[model samples]
Target: MAWVTWRQHRPQLVAAAGLLFALAAAALGTRIPIEAAFHRESLAACLPPAARTGCDIIVPHFEAEFGGLVTSVRVLTVLPVLAGLFVGAPLLARELELGTYRFAWTQGVTRRRWLLSKTALLAAATVIAGAAASAIVMWWRAPYDILEGRISPSSFDIEGLVVPAYALFALVLGVLAGLVFRRTVAAMTATLLAFGATRFLVTEFVRPHFLAPLHRVVLATDSGRGPGDWVLSDTLVDGGGRQITAAREDLAVTHAQLAGIDPHTYIVTLGWKRLIAYQPAGRFWDFQLLEAGLFVGLAALIVLVTVWLVRRTAT
Candidate 1:
């Protein structure tokens, strides 16, 4: 079974490996200079309040040099979908499209076993590729992550266990689509659409509620939320718990300035409080596990459904 799986999927396995290698090469090439600059500029020290002023100039310079690379990393977020289209969608769709499954199924192997073996082999490969890509990306972005935090959407999607889990979900989703569509092109298209929609839904709606976010009230003069904190909302409220409207804020600021008082100080004097709802940086690992587990569980459920479908439709 393993040998046959390998023979059938060698092209995909090789292509996936090649892509992972290219990504790693790119990450390593860019990482060298970034690491050098980090040490030379003493970026670690700059993160502290005592040295922040001095390092402010250096930080911007570093950003200026590597900002493009940081932005480019956002593209990695799509890799899981690509993996699904290329590896997972084609897994069964190609077999069924070309009528090869009929011949293969005539052999002594049970359809359930055949489906499980193929899915397992391909999914394992997808996971391994995801882990490698995640590791490389995480290392490449360490300096920036330290400064801005990994809790942000851009950073969170590419690091830790979640990346592999996402890949697995995509792969399984593709397989299910392939089984349902029975045409490679249609399966691929469906895989991309389903995977993208699911990702958007999870990131926008589900992620924030992973844990009940912490809330705190602060003086309006306080510098907003902490660096890297995933701030859900920042609203101004009075002691009476009435929300302060933006128009009222502008009027207050204008009045305070006319009276030669600091606008923030006047606002505070009026007993307006800044209410911050946020997920702190400390919950990075916890969130990673929660999200990874969610996707992995979904993948398992999809795999079960695909297996049932394959068996039911088998000759």
Candidate 2:
């Protein structure tokens, strides 16, 4: 049965393997020192000759951020999508379409057993593929991450969280789509649409809440009277990268003596900002766990649905 399953799904497996191999090769090739030096080479066109300091951090006059964005898109966005589509879309739909389920059923394999074996096999393969791709991306992007200051935990919280989980979700979603649609083409299309929609919703609407809800802080300094008043604003961890909003602490005013008269200036409060930053007391871990559980639960739910559908399905 296992051999039969492998033979049946060999096309998808081969395609997935080939795609991953190409991605791996491209990633490795791009990691060469020369490749990094040449990334976005067109940016040099905008720089003045004198301004071209050979210092590492020199801005290329064009968008330096574009390279990192492209890398992120390739690693975290494109590959996982292809994995989901190729791995999940045809798990069972092909069987139904080809009328091969009759043969398997007549051969004394229970529908549940058949479904379980295939799901287990495919799910394992999907996870392995995702893991390998992620590891490769992480390794290849390490230098770029350091150069771009993306190693900061805060940045990781946003980009890293969304991509992998979305990949897994997309895989499970493909399975469910295959079971529900029972046609190869329809399953692939539906899986892609549903996957894209859900990913859009989660990343935009739900992700910001994981870290203290996003808010803006208005900051300004005032010089006046006896001393410059440093208002008491929100206290954040120094160098811990937490952003907060609060009133400034009282500050004393100080000035240098002019030729004749001492210059005195005072600052009056104009207004507060349109938004404020505040950390949820301790919801950080809870949010992470919640998101993780949500993805796993969603995957489980889809698997269960697939199982039910398979039992009832003739194939």
Index of the highest-TM-score prediction:
1
Candidate 2 weakest lDDT stretch, 10 residues: 223-232
- Per-residue lDDT tens digits of candidate 1, residues 16-67? 8899889889888889999999999888887746455667578779888988
Each model's total of backbone clashes? 0, 19
Local accuracy of candidate 2 as per-residue lDDT tens digits, 36-126:
5545443233233333455335433222644655445443465566656877777767766787767776667787887778777776777
Local error of candidate 1 at residue 204 (angstroms) = 1.6
Model 1 ranges with Cα > 4 A deviation: 48-53, 250-269
Tell me each candidate's TM-score: 0.91, 0.65
| CA displacement after TM-score superposition, residue 113 of candidate 2 (Å) | 1.3
Q: Rate the local accuracy (lDDT) of all candidates.
A: 0.88, 0.56
Position 141, candidate 1: lDDT? 96
Candidate 2: list runs displaced more than 4 Å.
Answer: 34-76, 147-165, 214-292
